[model samples]
Target chain A: MKDQNGFDELARQKLAERDFTFDPSHWTAMEGLLARPGRKRGAWWPWLAAGVLLVGGATIWITAREHDPAASVTNPGGGPRAIAGEVKGVNGSAAITEMENASYGNDHPGTMNADPAVPVTGETRATAGTMRGETSGEPRMRTEATRTRKEHGTGTSDRGTVTMQVNKIPVSSISVRQGEDPHAANVRTGEATNDVSSTMTGPGAAAVAGDGASDERSNLATGAVDPVRSDASAAPAGGGTHGEEQPDSVLQHQPPSAGTGPVVVAGSGDSASTGATAAPAPVDPVAAALVPPAWLAITAPYELTLLGGAFSTTGRYTGVDAESWPARTERQWTTDFGLEAVRNFGRHFAVGTGVHFSSYKERLITDEVSRTEQQLSTSYFWVAHDTMVTIVVGDTAINGATYHMTQLVPMTINELGVDTDTAYQTMVIRQRRSALNTVSYVELPLLLDAHTARGRWVFGLRGGPSVGLLTGRSGSLPDNSGEGYHTLNEVAFRELTVGWTARAYVRYRLSAGWSVGVEPTMRGQLFNSLRNADLDRRASAMGMMLSLSYRIQPTPQP
Target chain B: MINDHIIAGCVRQEPKAQYELYRALYPMMMAICTRYERDRQEAAATMNQGFLKILDNIGTRRKEVPVEPWARRIMINTVIDAHRRNKERKAMEGADIDDHAEGTSGINDYLKDMEAEAFAELLHRVPAMSRTVFNLYAIDGFSHAEIAGMLGLSEGTTKWHVSHARTVLRNAIAAEAMARTEKTVSR
Candidate 1:
């Protein structure tokens, strides 16, 4: 026994002092198990968000154009209409006087006089004397004629007495002799009809006449006598007993009058007529060309924007040992997209609020222990010995010694049992792996934007407080033991977080109502992501944002 | 020997520190694992598993305790765990006690002259369970009662396994010594 003990002691001593050969590949294998693959999967989220915004903007533009009622009226060719030459009667003295005569003759035919030298003075007029004139040895008689006999309750007269006014200036009655040449009268009537038709059918005459008549006419012909006479002659020559009503029919096609122009009243005399009416105003083509289309005249104060951006996310860690946790977190790309509605206070400052979906991602490398189960099959042999009893026939003839009919004999037997048993065992392995921690939130941000515009470009700075509600969370964190990681659910995470966002933006106007902008933004969290966590972590991101905006003009009041 | 700086670096999981620590402890860890495993590949695999456990739990280790002893204890426990997982009962081989008694004194002399590798090779000839029990009781300084609990056997059974392992190893060493002596005589 002592010799065996001595041998055991010697063996322990020798083995304890001995060193064995080691292969360096063992560490290599361990390192391979520890390494985690780089996270490149989420880098495309920002690009996808930008694409969605672009597509949505284009769809809205196309739909607006298709549904706009004024598109056909203002832009029949599906392109921008010219504003200069298209707006007639804006600068021409003759054009304004002709338009006014046509408008007054068509609307109130009771106030029209057959003599071209006298104009309608008031809403109602009474003519009591006939006027005679001789031109080229032809005697012409002027009379009062109601174009619509039912409207004015008066019949057409060739020689009855009539009273009239010239361009709102009352004048004495002038009579023309009877028996005038019909061919010369018809020739004068044709020239007057052509002049009225050309003035009424001019480009933008309908639009200008509707609103421009009241305002623009104030700066137009105040007392243009010749153009007024020509236009007035067409009224009687076209709607008189000769059955020439072509000029009146053409004037009826003009757009309805928005309002009446100013009327100047003067005493009943030739001197009073020329004295009360002032000289014609000068033409201003620049002022005439500056008029915007009816659709663009109203200002829109509300803007809707679709914004998308990608950010490089990082975290600041405090309140714990840096070595126990991750020394440095890897920055990852994440994305956000949402809609915003802004009310412009003026051209420079605006307040905006909206809903957004934003996600923050961080990568942490941690060492963890994992267990795997394996099944093992083992085969073995079992040996046993047993006693067996058997009956043997004895020689019955042996004797009368006993009536032994049968005798029992004992025998030895060997038994062998071979079987296979299945069992399971767990193998534990530790590895270093990267955990991509992603926390998503639905955010509501209130931002104040200040901007200055030049031509088609706008430069601005926007900043605001943002509140976020936790929507989804995933990832792993180092456990209390620092030996392995636990799922993110095991940690106490904040259900709500507050943050600040700041950005500088540059926007380019694509059209009158549409614009596209690019902004460089920075967002930071004010509190830790997890409550009572070992590490106090605040996440922040820097990113570039793309936005598409549209101005929503209010409907014009009737 | 591991220093405080190395421990601190390992706790931080620095790759350079981990590699240094691994190289420093490789020889000792391999020596312990090879004693219980069948070959170098199995030993290497088992040593790495124990090393991972060491790295994982190094931060929790008490600073007052020496690192080498603590690491050695973990490696020893890991080897025992592996032995229990693959435990199988093999038919016991009877040693020729009559010849063994005459060669006992010569075997003891030969054991003192044998290298650790040769001694380990001879010990590997013993059955798996007996070899594990013998290693725990003899070289590792574990009590027979502790071996029984670790291997899930009774104290008597553990004692029998250790005796059987010693018998086998003694016979093997005797045979090898006789062969060497015969070669010397022939030469």
Candidate 2:
């Protein structure tokens, strides 16, 4: 037995010295496990960056489109062409007539400034003039003109040789007066019929009579120009000889309706008769570029929203032996914040995507079996015997048996000692403990919303899937043995979880570009929170959300 | 030996330092795990789990104490935790009986020399409980009382298991010796 023990010692020494071959594969596996927690913590960064880049790219594209000159010109019915017609007239000839009429000396007949040596009959006039008119009561016509110059026909006039270029005129120079009959004013000035004849003979007269009538009417409705004042100003300047000859010649070609109210012409002067002999007034390209395209007024708007809310959170558990642990989870509060960007498709529909952070918290109470080690002392009585011997020395020699004698005696002994044994007792404790579990996640939501506006109020419904990356966890849960609680921080939760969110919101527009809203929301997870766990836990929250939204208006790119 | 810098780096979860520590501790951790586990793959897995715990708690380690022993203690605890988790399944399978029956035979050929590898093979021949108890009490320098507390057994039971493990190893060594002698005589 001794030799065997020695050999056992030898064997133990050898076993202690044992070393298995090192396999790099094991380290590879370990490295992966080590990186897992860190990877999960940083998983949301890429998603966040992607969302920022998407929003940034969208902003750049929208702004780029807003400032692009080519973009404005892409629309055929509006933009620069419309601006030109708005400020000047259909063609240069009409602008010349407006300039010539506007430049007429109002009270001086000889100061008419008609250059007869240059023959205003069949020659182009480069004229820049400004006209300002005000009427008293109802909607009145207002005509704006820049300075007029005869580039090729610079002959001496009574007012001296008038030749100058007017690069730009301020928009403030235009004004509309209310309550004035343009034809009555023209007739009161005694230039009604001749003014009509001059305007009809201009270059764009046919177009003004046809497709350009609405443009002319729109301009008139807005009191952009007043032909009555133009004719009144022109009558004293050249209405005597020039107007009489032009009226007779031009009236021969009048469309019968010319009799009714001076034809409501766009321009009125003798210089306007030669339709092909006028140069368009020079306009500031910068001002023309300021007018937004017609399409932009109806273009979809983008909304950026910052939202926050509190929710009632609940967790539903399922799977293996799930019912055995009947953990009653108390409804708790969940809080969330998000930044969202929505691109409106039109007035009624929008699509949004954003990043959010949410914390889910719950208190769970359940039955657990607790084991404790206790020491117990066990005592018993036992009888112990001791033999006693007695000797008689002197008288033993004479009587052989009487000289010495030995006697035996028995005694009972009792003692106490400490017990080194340990005993474990299992107790079922019911509802005596509760654990608070909290999990935080970074979520990216993609939503589609449909909304309608009524007065200052807007109502909408938004719903979609949100993908979440678990960022952190805390607290505890029942262990698999139901013997105690295990710290949830050590639990392997799923790194990524998908969920669905739906909300209905009512918002009140605070201004042209800002709104505030209240939304009632519900969100629920679609997958288990724990990875490879027997228990399937899905969390859900119902909350009221308050949101502040700003409509991102497309600004002119500087 | 792992230095303080390596330990601090591990606490910071630096991958290079982690790999360095893993390399330094692999031989010791694997030896301990394989003594308790029969399969090499399972032993490696258990070692990794223990290493992870060591890395996680390395910052809390007493600077005065050497790192190897501290890491070994954590590795042992991890093995015990894994044992407790799988205990019910092991009990249901009645694996202890099969292990004992298989441990007693056909192990002499592996005991040609009492080298560490051969000794490890011999140790695996012992029954699971007896082997684990023996490893803890003998090689790991755990007292019978400590082994009893760890395995939830009486001290006497722990002693019995140790004695049983020694007997098994002793018999296998004797068998190998006799086989050697017989071969010599035939030659």
Candidate 3:
């Protein structure tokens, strides 16, 4: 219990001493941080996640369209353009059989042969499942069907036509064979809007004969042949031009809209030619060389700033051994303003300097002793009975009288031992006195600065030595004690003193080229304010500064 | 300014009132901060941050209760935060527990006239954990269980830390007293 009580008392006594003094600049710096706009540090992540999701969705959607063949053929408001036919020998003959509306199969958009020979103009054909196969240029017997739905008779259409080249050797051109006029069906879609030709460019019959000779020979003997074997590669090359056979679903051309720019379809060799020219546009070397980097284009090199703030003077006794003292410093409200210009070398670093006009007033409380002289006076009641005195009662002086007279003598004596009836009075005297010291320094500082910036935030550290050329000095003691206020002579303070100034600050950009910031600064004199004062006694200034800055745009490179 | 008025103003977040309260309470808070952080600059920073916290959470303080303990708790929390931030550095500087203990002086009279600053300086010599335990248990009137919960330690470990801190402080204080005595005798 004794230990606990001791600890409690110790803690209380120790913790209660509030004499701790901090560097005023540090407090100002903290104030600057507190006064800054609140940070939105935690808010950026959700937006970043949303952006990732959007990009991922777009990527997946693009990939799906590139591989889905049926999706390519089935245009909006138009049914699939299927071509149904049965091809046989000279005796059996081939014919267009059926047509029907159908959705694309929910599988890899590969080629398919329709259910055996339905009427082409009628709507009775079956929707066929997609058939997967390798590329084989061979004769095989099968019935195929197609359905075509024509909606908009005038605008754009998904009227796709398949042309099977059935020459004995490598067929270079696959012409569309019309139902009635096979010769006229070879027209390109660009020449006739009604004609839709999917050009499959490859060496055809030779590949089939080498790879499927047995199958071809058997079908040839049977005197019936499916002209187009359902090879996956036999699928229309929607717009592919780079050796690889592409699925037909990816659009070779964008649908036309009244107000839209001409659509540039990627991977379409013909569209690229038609869209611009078969030849590349001429490049201008000088213009290309003149382009500036994106970041530099938005940055300015020179910046100017204006700052204004309040400052307080902080001072401590130079080397007081004991923590108790008459040594202290008090401050008056001081204001400062500055103008600075900075030259930024790049995004990360800059150098600058500024001129500041400031005033500092502080009362230095010191003990001074002085003394004066005065005439001493004393008054006391001294009673005496003279050798030949008549005793007289009641405050009467008896000089030379008989005892029947009864006289009494009483007197007051001065410090010089003079007898008097009155109480003594002291003369006016001059005396020593100690008075509180008041001092002020008006300073004009020129300081160098350096700083860096990231995104919207900037941090800077600046400092340099400056001289305090004291423009004026004034002092007076508190009134009513000895005399009213008395102004001291100029010799009491130094004419000039050297000091260093430093500050660190953070700023945030409020808009283009304009920013607001707070700076915490420390300024101190190397020597004491008084001419022959103690070496440890000097004036220190700490302040919080608010500033506005504007970046000047650099002229564009010639 | 009256303490209650300062509390009311701080709760309202009036900057002038807040600054007034800061000036009023700064010394005691600085004492705690300096004790926790030997570096004067860091101690100042810690004290500023603690004041910020007090102002930020002033609404939670009950009316008519003493403000010192509440402010002290916040300052301690700030100290703990600072400690956690520099835990690795402290550990590197040998703040961790070790089995070896220094011999105690067993002299309690030395504490009778010890200056507050001197006592604090002596307390700084104790290992961080023991010093914290001693402060909480002996001075702040926290139970071992509370110290254990606060420091994430067991009750037994907390008890050991208090004992260790007392022994270290007693020895250091006693040694200081003996040195002063010898210096006086020589003089």
Candidate 4:
């Protein structure tokens, strides 16, 4: 037997080669997929899409109701109040909701900036399996509150409403006119608060917290003057519209706890009423409009993959020809099949799992090799999810199909007058061997996706290790006595095996509905003993793949 | 089908920018499995299978990532996954099993001097099982706890599997220790 290299040293070397260059391949199938328009469906991806649709849809619905008269009159939180008929006076139920909405729009102060990095693991590779520590709290990503203004410029010549500015735009009432830049109106209204020092930040907070706080904060925020004009039918009604007035009154209110902080509400005008005849003032603090956002709401995407795999050991591997170590090699093919499913928790993040099965065989590429072949031997992989990190941990076959070694010299082609360089004459020495094995394990991969084009294209770099346990293998290296062949190691191979892999791929989304991708990968064995007593000696194989995919959103439309 | 957004992993080696990288390329990676794999399920499994190597060694295989000929390496492997299948066939043929005392330390310890990249290369030398353990405990941040939970192994057994990594790596390192040490700088 010949000597081999140190397994640990090899592993280190293998890992250090993270600098592999990239190569782009044409993925016909995937490219075609990206080019051909299609719809997207998914497992968990659907849920993510659905979640966005629900919230986004609700937001849109609110926006559509912005110009409705009934909505405006019914709203108790916005600043515009309607003049109802009957006994209603100059001051109907003061809109408390409007007062609160007004305070929320211009009073509170906050800022947006970059947050700190949250480290999830340690620096060294040895202690890779150590438990992770907790990270610090982070700030909210963003906070925005819009204020709408309707200017009656020189449109029909019959309108006198020169300009009306309504602060604090609800999700439902953004705008219908195309290509109009709204002005940012900031009002200095935090002066009335003397005893409102609790958590509320506004002039009117003092009126509610300490003394008799009426429902007037919403009016201050909305800035909607009373004598309301009807424009519900003239709204940017999708596709077809003619009416310039709404049947329902519009209502707007600042949702409690809008962003990531505490939300405070007082006993202000939470109730607002809009009717035909009533003592209407220049400004009502009770009623306002609601409007939802549009396509800008689509901030993230859902991802899915249909995958297939084939693994063959028709290459140099552990102890397959143990007798000569590296010099004598035996080719083995382990046909394995796998299926995996993945779901993204958010835009560049996800988790998944899979199932694996394989069949093993030992074949001598040269006369110097002859070993056992395992069939339909079972094994499976458990993983956190799918990633490009290329960690392939899970169960594996060991001596389950060990290729014991028997030294044998090659048959020289020169004996037959054939030149060594001639394809007609090939010389090779092989070894005879046999073994058995079965293994199962799990893989965890953390991926790094470098994003560009506002998340349209991405090149991914992922790496994480995997863990596994060797369950069992052929109890003994079985002899081919029935075939009159001697067994090299009549005993099973090692119970446990370990190694690592490094790989990468690049992907591009051609449009909103399609994407194409490709990746060339290489896997090298870092350790051994899973096959022969072979040490340090490793094997490697490289491959390329091309694929395509599409994007799909939920029904509600985010 | 190359979209404008994806950059091959080979071009990106910085440790600080990995999370975003994995996300952008995962979908197309899933589609890649259809070729060599029997079906989408197997392809997906193989993609996850590649994780053992990817998570553990992508930082080192930077060369392979870029030089890949139109083939993006999305952590999905083919040959290594084949090892178990080969073994399975032999098992059906009645190969023997040997339960012996696993040797410890000696050359295995000396080989430790080699860098992490070297070890990652050597991992590709053996069956899939060995690589899985070495990566799980040595590179991918999986704890024996999580590893055991995922692989359905006793924590103790999972630990033993990790220890077994030394033997597999030793055999590979012992063979090309010199060439590895010299070329280590290239990574």
**Could you give the interface RMSD of candidate 1 in angstroms?**
5.8
- Reference-based TM-score of each model: 0.33, 0.33, 0.31, 0.25
Residue by residue across A94-116, what tens digits does model 1's lDDT show? 11111122221122211112223
All models, DockQ values? 0.18, 0.20, 0.11, 0.08
Ranking by DockQ: 2, 1, 3, 4
Candidate 2 residue-wise lDDT, B1-187, digit = tens: 5766567657756565677789899989998899888778999999999998988788788999899999999999898788778776434332333323223433433443557776677567777777778888877888888888998999999888887777776665656566777999999
Candidate 3 ranges with C-alpha deviation above 4 Å: A1-26, A39-558, B2-14, B59-67, B92-106
> Judged by DockQ cut-offs, is candidate 3 incorrect, acceptable, medium or high?
incorrect
Candidate 4 Cα outliers beyond 4 Å, as residue runs: A1-305, A309-336, A357-491, A494-496, A499-526, A529-540, A545-558, B1-187
Per-prediction interface RMSD?
5.8, 9.7, 7.5, 14.3
Cα lDDT, model 1, residue A14: 62
lDDT per residue as tens, model 4, A1-558: 112344433444445444422212222232333234431221344356435544654443354344332243222222222111000001111111111122222222211111112111111111000001111121000111111211110111011111111122211111111011010111111111100111111111100101101122222121121211221111111110001121222111223212111112111122111111100112232222131122212233554433233333322333333333312223454433333334445433444443323222334322233354433433443334333333334455576864434444333232222222212323332343433322222322233222222233444422233223343322122222222232323434344444333334456667554566664333334455344353223333334445454455555545
| Quality of model 2 by C-alpha lDDT | 0.52
Error of 3 at A555 (Å): 59
All candidates' lDDT scores?
A: 0.52, 0.52, 0.45, 0.30
Residue-wise lDDT of candidate 1 within B1-187, one digit each (tens)? 5677578767867565677688889888888888888677878888888888888789899989999889988998998888777665323322222224434677777888988778888777778788788888888888988888988999999888877777787888888888888999999
